[model samples]
Target: MFIGGLGRSGTTLLERLLGEVPGVAPLGEVVHLWERGVIGKEPCGCGEPFTTCPFWRRVGIRAFGGWSTGLADRILTLRRRVDRTRHIPALAARRCRVGLSGYTRAYSRVYEAAAQVAGGRVVVDSSKHASLAFCLRTSPVVDMSVVHVVRDPRAVAYSWRKQITRPEDGTPMTRWPSAWTAVHWLVQNLAFELLARRGGTVIRVRYEDLLADPPAVMQALLTRLGLGGVAVTFLRQGVAELSVAHTCAGNPMRFAAGPLDLSRDDNWCDRQPRLHRWLVTALTWPLMLQYGYRPRDRRTPEGAVAPWLTAGVAAQECR
Candidate 1:
């Protein structure tokens, strides 16, 4: 029961929701174990420092073989040397095969480790990345059910702009580059598109709809996973409490909840300028509209805001 989507695409929110259901263990971003050895003192949103967390300690013992505590300590120590900025492209280029073999091995390690300790056939991983998803679909170790979460691009960019701003940097945040955001969203969602075409269990979830009506959304999600009738316990925590902002690299699963903040839906209108609006629309209009976003021209005057991409794309730009 792995749950994933783009960074900042509500992966954390979804994991916590699913975790509340009995029999489901939603581990935020156990991605550390597979990240080719980069870690941080950043505590997991699971409410434990990674190395000291009971959950990860068990995972370490079962997956790597040895004292869980010792393995966790080693991971934290090795993690210190990691250069966050370059790890992804470097590892994806160097270790990930265009084929499925390498991916299966990597995913197997993580899944087996989780299952061994958690004692569940399904695992929830909110570390959304399309490339990784594609690799897992073809891997022998995992039978993945992908939920590609979509959100409005404007809201996503707005959220990202806020998140990236730093008091020390003293630089105002700007809209994410449209071309970059557009291509990234396209490729990642397209990964799911291709996978669905290949004939497998894949679901597309809209974040807007999920938040708007959680019970229905969650029920449908569990049914798809063949785990039905689970109690839906939605946590109401603040955003920072849930944020993995201080965690290793960054895990979207670390978000705090609050009263329904639908303001996030159209936040880009307030954040992006006229030019960025034009650029984002021109580059992403076709894809954006495909997943429930309406162009400004089609919207009512009151809704005459800029066009938005799907929630998935929107969240990426923001994150």
Candidate 2:
């Protein structure tokens, strides 16, 4: 049961919790062939390095032609050579689709090989990308179960702004103006919404509820995936330490490494900049309303029907 979604949408938390479960192998973001030069890295908190890691090593054994580690590095170089200065959406789409095809081929080969190595029925990959999700679903080798994880739009924009501003001299992305950011939030969410509805076992998970009560949320997910009851013991242990990788080489992000941490809910209220809160709300307002988020603008918040409150959340009271 692969847990897929947008970045920073609690995939790591889910991976960690599920990793603790017996009989389930959790390799967070093993996007091995997507970009290259990843294997020689240090142990990701999951207790293994890319090169020496049993997971990838086994995956390497079965991959048809034994693709080199340098494959990802080469792809990165080619991507950098592309010119995308004007930010034209049509051009961007055309260029991205062209490049995406190669990556998809490599990804499919690597995962198919890795699946053989793991010897487990399911491999959880939290490398969330709508395009990749689309490709994987269509691939003959993959029988993917996509988990469309979502959070408030304001929260997403807030986090994006934080990461974009951090110390990165190379490949820095321009910050989206609030309106543009909202538009992006809607677009990405809409993509997932459409995919989920077209559905064959697509699950939508909310970051808020997942953080608020992980064990219960996880149990429901495992049941839905038909993962049996083996995950229960892992849930009782609280959290597990796991390794993770980013889309770029040498740019790994750990689960507990930074400010917009997922170990808790309401991270937005705590870590978000004052300005981002408004932008987040504006962009994600419709979604927030749709997903049962209480609308602050209304006298009676959205979804506030009497007896609507579950006993567990009743003490918190309605907004």
Candidate 3:
């Protein structure tokens, strides 16, 4: 499973939850493994530095005959050429299969290795980048399913404005202005919707709904993913017992484990500034309403999205 969405929309939490499933292994964010995991040697979710984690050590040997500066740099270069948002148009049209193949081979090796190391549990990658998701769609080696997570745009904007820390390297998390995050939120979610329309096992999951009923949402998710018989041992009545994961690069929350409260946090409703909230609603109202989010004001500007496109995403969500 490839869980894709904007960064702060609970993708990490979702992965950790899914990892507790009997036949699942959550990989934090393989998209950043070259830089954050291999080159920089950040802490893996297991509390070992990536280079020392036995799982990752085995993954390196299995995936690329051992991770090296040359391998990391080569894959990073391939990523630059093939995985940017600007390349999405060509990727979606299947016009860049040749360009994507090399990257896809290297990328699939990571998942393939992790699955073998985890005793063949289904691997879950919470990369959360639509462009990377598009690239993976063409992989001959991966049978990928996507859970496109969406949170309220206002809440997501608030998250981007905060000052958080990256625990592994003691660096501050990146911050963005509400307007920039709003636009990013718009584009990122749109890209996933485009992925849905293009076809695959794509499911839309609202952050709010997941919080409301953890076990039900999780079980339904597995069923949708065609793993319905897997025992739902992780989530229990809005609480969970999280196990250590080996996710690569993601929010610092990746390190957290044990009992977790799946609570509904509406801090943004009271704390986000009024103007920024309005700005996000204005920019994302069309897609917002499609996902059952009601903007403060429901007047969508003319031509914000083609009518057919709107209908297309909604139809795709049901599939």
Best by TM-score: 3
Mind giving the per-residue lDDT tens digits that candidate 3 earns over 21-95?
887888889989999888999989989999999999999899888988788898899998889988888888988
Q: What clash count goes with each model?
A: 20, 5, 1
Candidate 2 pairs with clashing backbones: 35-72, 36-72, 36-73, 46-243, 154-280
Q: Name the lDDT value of residue 9 in candidate 3.
A: 89
Error of 1 at 156 (Å): 2.0
Q: Candidate 2 on 115-212: residue-level lDDT in tens?
A: 56655566667766554465454445567777667666666566556544222224454555556666766666666565565553567777766665
- Model 3's lDDT to the true fold? 0.82
Evaluate residue 242 in candidate 3 and report its C-alpha lDDT on the 0 to 100 scale.
Answer: 83
The TM-score obtained by model 3 is 0.92
How many times do residue backbones clash in model 2? 5
- lDDT per model vs. reference: 0.53, 0.53, 0.82
Q: How accurate is candidate 2 locally (lDDT)?
A: 0.53
* Model 1 C-alpha lDDT per residue in residues 165-257, reported as the tens digit of each score: 422223454445555665566666665565566664667766766665556566767766678666555433212112222222234334333
